[model samples]
Target: MINNTIVQELIHEIVKEEEGVPVVECLMEGSITDEEIAEKTHLKLNTVRKILYKLYDAGIASYKRSKDPETQWYTYTWKFESEKIEEIIKKRNQEIIENLREMLAFEENNMFFACKNGHYRYTFDEAAENNFRCPECQEELEYMDNSEIIQQLKRELSLYENNGSEIAFNFKSYS
Candidate 1:
């Protein structure tokens, strides 16, 4: 599994930077009134109202309104849903795995060549385009064996396969 500390930190950082920190925090705590959130966050009432509206529209949080008998103004309360955070993190993990696969394929299968006398290497096409001659030594270029590259790619893919499911599971647990 991915480290719980890393996952928790990522979640905290994302939520903290969200436009309505007070609303999010209050919602996470339980249903809380807008005025209470504003007071706790040290933000103006109008600003807190705007933040609540935005959070509601984003579907990251929701609210209920209760009419105050003394003033007749609707008091807004909020709550956060855990599912949305899980969905976002799961999508990110899928993208990372796809990118890793693409990189491994490129590293393992793409043809390469290198100059015997120097440390330079080129792809098969590059060597052919250069008349099979090393630009530095004027020596003929030959196809480099790719077994080592393929082996390394296999190793990396194995690591990903081993860890990817656990990472995804941990991310879900956080949500």
Candidate 2:
């Protein structure tokens, strides 16, 4: 199963193309020059450059460039920033938790009514004002039970809260 981090998914997709490639293995070791990465991975120089650029754009990779005095050529040393991936995972989980809070509040606050035809839903005030009739079907509007949905949201929020901290701790240790 895929984890929640976007970084993980992107890395997975890239590594899936070729197993035991140097682009990934060498970077995973530590900081490595692009040329070294290409040589070690047996991948074309252009392919290694493309991979580094892609990771750099995603903030999961970083590089430092230096000019060679003798050759007058620029050298770029790249490193995989595992910390950045952990940060992204935290951000994604936080956003998910915040959205869950907003949805739970909305679901728990309003009293909704739905028609027997299962069409549209309205708040209690709207249903009362509309004579408890469905706007489209004109049938009686009954109370909508949202407890199940609210419970589900609660469960999701709890999962994020509980898992986020543990994941952060393990990520730090691994880094």
Candidate 3:
């Protein structure tokens, strides 16, 4: 399983880099008042309110109001839902796997050809359908070797397999 440190780092990076709105790093901490968020993040109360609203609309956070009996004022506490992070992580991992699978298929199954003069390449079917000639130079085409691409794809597949399992296990353990 991935370490907690790794998951935390991923969350931090994602929150910092997400577009349009500031992501709350303390979502899981508990519902927090706008004033509390402003104090913690050094942002103005209005800005904190906007960011909190954005997070809420994105389904990334939730809040509840607590009334102060003495002053009759409402306050909020905020916390993060661990399940949301897991869902995002799992979706990202699935996208990676799908892209990698396409790469592996192209490397393992597609045939390629190279031009002798410019060393430009074409897929096997393209060369064959064009009578084994380079379309750019009208020169004979040579069958390109797949060994290097195949080896690289194998290495990438191994990495995905290893990391995917680790991340999945971590998500389960945390959830």
Candidate 4:
């Protein structure tokens, strides 16, 4: 898709600004050698290679290796995979949504009580067995208001879901 905005954001999330600079520039170019990337990004060659390797390990980048015929120096040319980035972000967002949903379900289905003194939460059965008192401070337990927390989780979940849909995979070959 020849996109730089989304690729820059994704690289920034994966690496430091300095590291992300080269990665974003080179990645948008489809593919480039580490040396060229370093020169273009104004970074040290070793730094560029290290950052590229890290991205590759994360499956955000891929590379092809070749050897110079004369010097026999092995060189790797890398390309940032936009398709993989979208998949990673979407997967992570879905995982977060799942966790939030589980928490919301728990909060809605369970009756929770809290100690007025220490703010410790306990299930209804625990509170009742303890005579509606705080086990630690011996203070009276009150009904815990988790509505705000539930609402917040719901909002976050919705945001993630919405953001997940923002990226449309073009699946076009950069090469």
Query: Which is the leading candidate under lDDT?
Result: 2
lDDT over C-alpha atoms for residue 117 of model 3? 94
- After superposition of all CA atoms, the RMSD between model 1 and the true structure is 6.0
TM-scores across all candidates?
Answer: 0.54, 0.72, 0.66, 0.80
lDDT of 1 by residue, 1-175 (tens): 1135654444445544443544565667778887888888888888777766655665556778789999998877777765665555556657766877887787676788889987588877788889989988889887888788778767776776666677667766754
Give residue 151's lDDT in candidate 1 (0 to 100). Answer: 81
Q: Which residue window of length 10 is worst by lDDT in model 4? A: 166-175
lDDT of 4 at 15: 74
Clashes of each: 0, 0, 13, 0
Best by TM-score: 4
Question: RMSD per prediction, one decimal?
Answer: 6.0, 4.3, 4.8, 3.5
lDDT of 2 by residue, 1-175 (tens): 0233444555756544543244656887888998888788778888888878777876878999999999999999888877777777788789999999999999999999998998998989999999999989899999999999999999999999998988777675655
* Quality of model 4 by C-alpha lDDT: 0.77
- Local accuracy of candidate 4 as per-residue lDDT tens digits, 19-50: 66556667777789888888888888888887
In model 4, which runs have C-alpha deviations exceeding 4 angstroms?
1-9, 16-18, 126-131, 169-175
Lowest summed lDDT across 10 adjacent residues in model 3 is found at 14-23
lDDT of 2 at 15: 45
Q: Is candidate 1 or candidate 2 better by lDDT?
A: 2
